[model samples]
Target: MTDQPPTLPTSMRAGRILGPGHTVVVDVPVPTPGPGDVLIEVARAGICGTDLHILDGDYELARFPMTPGHEFAGVVVALGEGVRRSALGQRVTADPNLPCGLCPECQRGRANQCHDLAVVGVTRDGAFAPYVVVPERVVVPIGELSFAAGALVEPLACVVWGLERVRVRAGDHALVFGAGPMGCLLIQALKASGAARVAVVDLAPSRLALARSLGADLAVTPDELAALADVAPLGFELVVEATGVPSVLEGAVEHARPGGTVWVFGVAAGDAMARISPYTLFRRDLALMGTFAVNQTVPQAVALIQGGAVDVEPLVSHVLPIDAFAEGLRLAAHDPTRMKIQFSFGDASS
Candidate 1:
């Protein structure tokens, strides 16, 4: 049986980006879910690096006059025709990527690279508002999980997909650059995956401290990288660049041990270029790979969080209501101390 709220609003205030570097809060009609879809009353939505790119017109797929938010969790308030998999009032988070199954990449099980992808926030209106329409297929039920933590499942799912693509030797040492939210997730996941030691490097001391608290074997500023030699004299077996800075990625290859792997997991600008030595990779037998957004790994991410294998709520540093979106954007873009900036929606109110 489909259980919905007694009354639904006819309109709502949404965060809209009219053009590059322009945003406004406007009243838009509350969207109705179509067949196989569900209307979600967003509980929390986290701003991501990709959202910044969309604001700056760096992402080619972003549609102007669009709402930008994909990392979110909410309740299924209404269901559309043919949507029997999801129930009203179910707490859930969605996989934002909507890959066309007929694409060559999707046929090969690499759906993340779908040629004609229709992402929730990028190609369609998203949860920057209190309500969003998502296909029931992508909505994963997050039972009893806090909305704050549920919002983080998308980012963790990215790390889980990366883990599947790379080979993690038992008891290997891993070095992660950038102790921000993604870096912290990497460290804990590595530990749970049997990595004997994981060290994280970031310029911010506060972030390093957080990394250390989240099970990082060692967390140090870039200036203190020399200390890592004592732990992995030959070099680390795994080096992950999570900073999305080209300079960091260019230097990442130098720290990988012979036969080690360098995983590029950060979202760099599309036009940005990094210089690396092909000779070094060939001589060292090192593997270099990059994994995009989540594939069919949402279930694994939810399982990881539910089982206490990874702690995500501690990574959230800022939370604001939808009306303060401008300030939230400013802080998310320029605040040096910010970790994850999320918008909390109580009842879709202003």
Candidate 2:
């Protein structure tokens, strides 16, 4: 990144998700930056559950043999036609969502809710390569932000959106089920946004321990809820079920205080169903809110990471080379210790 290189090779090394249970590393054409686009030299890319879904062909919009990566940070290498900015050598991160401008949702300024939404990593080539072409509008400057923290902005943006619909008052007691990467981020985000204390529940002790290390007021297994009656005798004011499991979704409402809000923020299977009593919902006057991905929260997410308000550093447990991206997938699937496994495309590190 020292000297601004005039040009790069025609082809570059990249990781491609061929189909269900298939991945390959190969040399592919560096995508041509289109009008109002910027070519990025990928520094790091993070692996998440959605990546697996895309790889397994579970995402309806995903096509076969695609370079799969959504969360990434990089340096601007070149600018496309109609782009007047001097983006070369600038560090940056971008939102992966591509909402159709013609959609009603987009017209209403709710692009995340667009009916014809197309995600970069899911429906098109992403940053798990030496270079990727992204629209200039989605790109956000990562001033003094490390590539590792910058890559986390995408997920943090989603967390910000989750809280946008759910109320988080000062001194509010919160309970979060599922201490995975998103869950952990939710914990920090809640604290930063003014929640008094957060009790985390997860099946794994390691994840719970991480929750505690990250300033969670309480970290306990789901089975230990009975023992925590004295701590939140009435139940939490805010209940978030981060695990996409339907069973967890069904039972999470029970952990919310009467009239308290419940945020169903996880991505459950399209066909998945969680039974909640309509009678109870009416009787308790409880509010059940559903939040989708990030919408206009990228800048705040970037600020949070760069300002050290949310630490995703601990979440990145594995930092492997781009050549081992396939192996990174295996670890993401099987490794419980792995909170976030990222591919280092160049000099990127954990």
Candidate 3:
């Protein structure tokens, strides 16, 4: 008799998209790991604004009927042959962007610019399910970090990359536009990178409070920004725009001091564009830069979390089960009181 294929979990619970416009909870097959791959039993998945955009068909590069989750952490349950580097049962976080190492950008040490970048949850099925298959290289060992904290590594890595690109300096005053999770993370990173004072702007009161608790020296609303300008006429030395809104980018330029640097870290919509005064750009001698997803900052972020230099727990405001992913998305999208919403696996036992 011919040997049958090894039995795997027949059905896995996942949050699936029914069409380009809708999402629902459904049962899907648990994927099998292939060569140079590792199967992760997702313990926690973080909901991000990008996930909301993906659900609303606002992100131009997303695939429909996709399981939408990219920021995640879990335990490695299976490894394909030739994957002797990582052991099973190890706690880990995943790098969502899978790049072809042989691509021109990758060959030039700019993996974030890879031409064939396949983002988990965006281009393919991702960690919204109980199990996800990821390439071995994209998996990073998290050691003993909690699943929730580990889930933030991916986002934190992106923040670290942006921070490095901006090259913040000691005693520099930074103006952070937005008080959401990413903005809060940037606040902490700016402080850690030696900024003397950091100011945050957001419309949400709760988020502004959280930003203060996380190290923001000042948290102000949009309306209050003008009053703040009275204190610093030329505005801040470094302006970090975390709000993806185009208007915020324009405001960031307005608030930046002469000869200051503005780092645009937010991911705006595909068609969105920020308007700037070319004359002001030349007269102010301002340096404007944009940072994309991480290239080599994952390990640095992990180390900062592990060494207790940056706190991730305060940023995680909600933890729900995977079945409640839609609820999580809604909360992340509508609830200003919430910071980071994470999906947990099982009844907290797993």
Candidates' lDDT values, in order?
A: 0.91, 0.85, 0.84
- Lowest lDDT 10-mer window, candidate 1? 1-10
lDDT computed for candidate 3: 0.84
Give the higher-lDDT candidate: 2 or 3: 2
lDDT of 1 by residue, 1-350 (tens): 33345598889989888988999999999898888889999999999999999999999999888999999998999998888789878899999999999989999999999999999989999999989999988999999889999999999999999999986889899999988889999999998888889999998888998999999988888889899887788999999999899999999999999999999998899999999999999999999999998998888999999999999999999889889988889998897667998999985321
Q: Which digits, one per residue and each the tens of the lDDT, describe model 3 over residues 1-350? A: 11113544767899877565587988998887788888888988888888888887888668787998898999887878668687778899888988888899999988889998888888899998888989888899999898888988988999988887788878888999888889988888888889888899999899898888888878999888766665466578899888789999997888888888989888788889878998888999999999998887888989988988778878888888777877888898788778898888864323
How do all the candidates rank in terms of TM-score, highest first?
A: 1, 2, 3
Show the colliding residue pairs in model 1.
none
- Cα lDDT tens digits, model 2, 1-350, are 22225567789889998888889999998777888888898888999788877776677778888998999999898888788764788899899998888989999989998899888787889988989888888899989887888888899999998887786989888888888889899999999989888888898899999999998989898788885566678888899988888899788888788878889887776678989988877888788999988888899999888778799888877888889988999988777667878888866442
* CA RMSD of all predictions: 1.9, 2.4, 2.7
TM-score of 1: 0.97
At residue 62, give the lDDT of candidate 1: 95
Off by over 4 Å in 1: 1-6, 347-350
Candidate 2 wrong stretches, greater than 4 Å: 1-5, 348-350
lDDT of 3 at 150: 92
For model 3, the stretches where C-alpha displacement exceeds 4 angstroms are: 1-8, 226-234, 347-350
What TM-score, computed on C-alpha atoms, does each candidate reach?
0.97, 0.95, 0.94
lDDT computed for candidate 2: 0.85
